[model samples]
Target: MMPRPLLLGFLAIVVLAVLWISNPAVAFAAGLVIALWQKQVDLPHISTVSRYALQGGIVLLGFGIQASQLWTLTTQFAWIVTLYIGVVIILGLLGARLLRMAATEGQLITGGTAICGGTAVVTLAPIIGAKPAQTGAVLGIIFLLNAFALLSFPTIGQALDLNQTQFGLWAALAIHDTASVVATAQIYGDEAA
Candidate 1:
């Protein structure tokens, strides 16, 4: 059997190939494999880098959308968004109950899904005084879901022949994280972004 270092090296090459192919599904699989097999993961450094990068991207993305245009969108989507959020929360609660998840976990999952992904969970967790483990678990769950969404969303959009507006709206409503939504939308097209 190959040693761990050699295995990591081989996987690094594969990761480069996956990125060159620009296939999100392949990228995700490669990333997972690398994460599992790469012994020197530097998790803390990686987390810091990723968090800052994601935050920076979100800020940069905001520049593209005008405040006035955003207001119009809020007006258009506000009521339905609220209703949708409520339904999602209820459904999540029921699912959590059936699955026997902790109340805190359920609430965090619901807030993450029904609102702006981990951001909602993070914000609400502090206000509600959640335990650290609960917050971490919810954040992990949301990130996992976002990774899944980023992997398949573009292919689904293409298969369905959804135009920019339709795909953008779907990404906004369906995706858990702002970064995932933006990445998927950009893959679909700039107009979607």
Candidate 2:
């Protein structure tokens, strides 16, 4: 017999697939809803499966990119990304000091906003001696802001009449996480990816 969570998850995917063409975010939102709904349904294995699936998807997404294109992006955006990292970090440090937040919490939040999102926060968490609760709070705030950006970025792109490169670069520069950047760029079209 199929496990309840897996079965429910499949059903949710099937249902969401119909709406995916209209909005990929709907599928993402649906899956999040499913995970929330499955709180008591052996999430350890389910989450493991989810993580592996995402890993495979990320690998596949990578295969679609060309080395030459990567070089072009590297040359084009390297300095820009570096500048943003420095500025964002410095600004975050100043804001943290101004707000009088706990140093560890502020550093985690800064790492998250300035680098590769949750990965940055998680990487710096142990180094900075942040508690799990602090990590979770930072993640919650970052992802919530990411969700808002994910929704609004397309409109902003259109309003700016941004070309693929411009939109992708903006998303890469402004978005907090890699996933949100990828998703936002994919929306702008394949070239943006």
Compose the digit string of candidate 2's lDDT tens values, residues 28-75: 676577667655555448668867876786789889988998898899
- Judged by whole-model lDDT over C-alpha atoms, candidate 2 comes out at 0.83
List, residue by residue over 1-193, the lDDT tens digit for candidate 1. 5675776588679968986886555666777877777656544576887789779968997999999988988898788778888899999999999999988888889889999998999998988789999999999989988887887888898999999888988998899878788878877888887
lDDT of 2 at 16: 58
Q: Give the Cα error of residue 41 in candidate 1, in Å.
A: 4.9
Against the true structure, what is each candidate's TM-score? 0.74, 0.88
Q: What local lDDT does model 2 show for residue 54?
A: 67
* Local distance difference test values of all predictions, in order: 0.84, 0.83
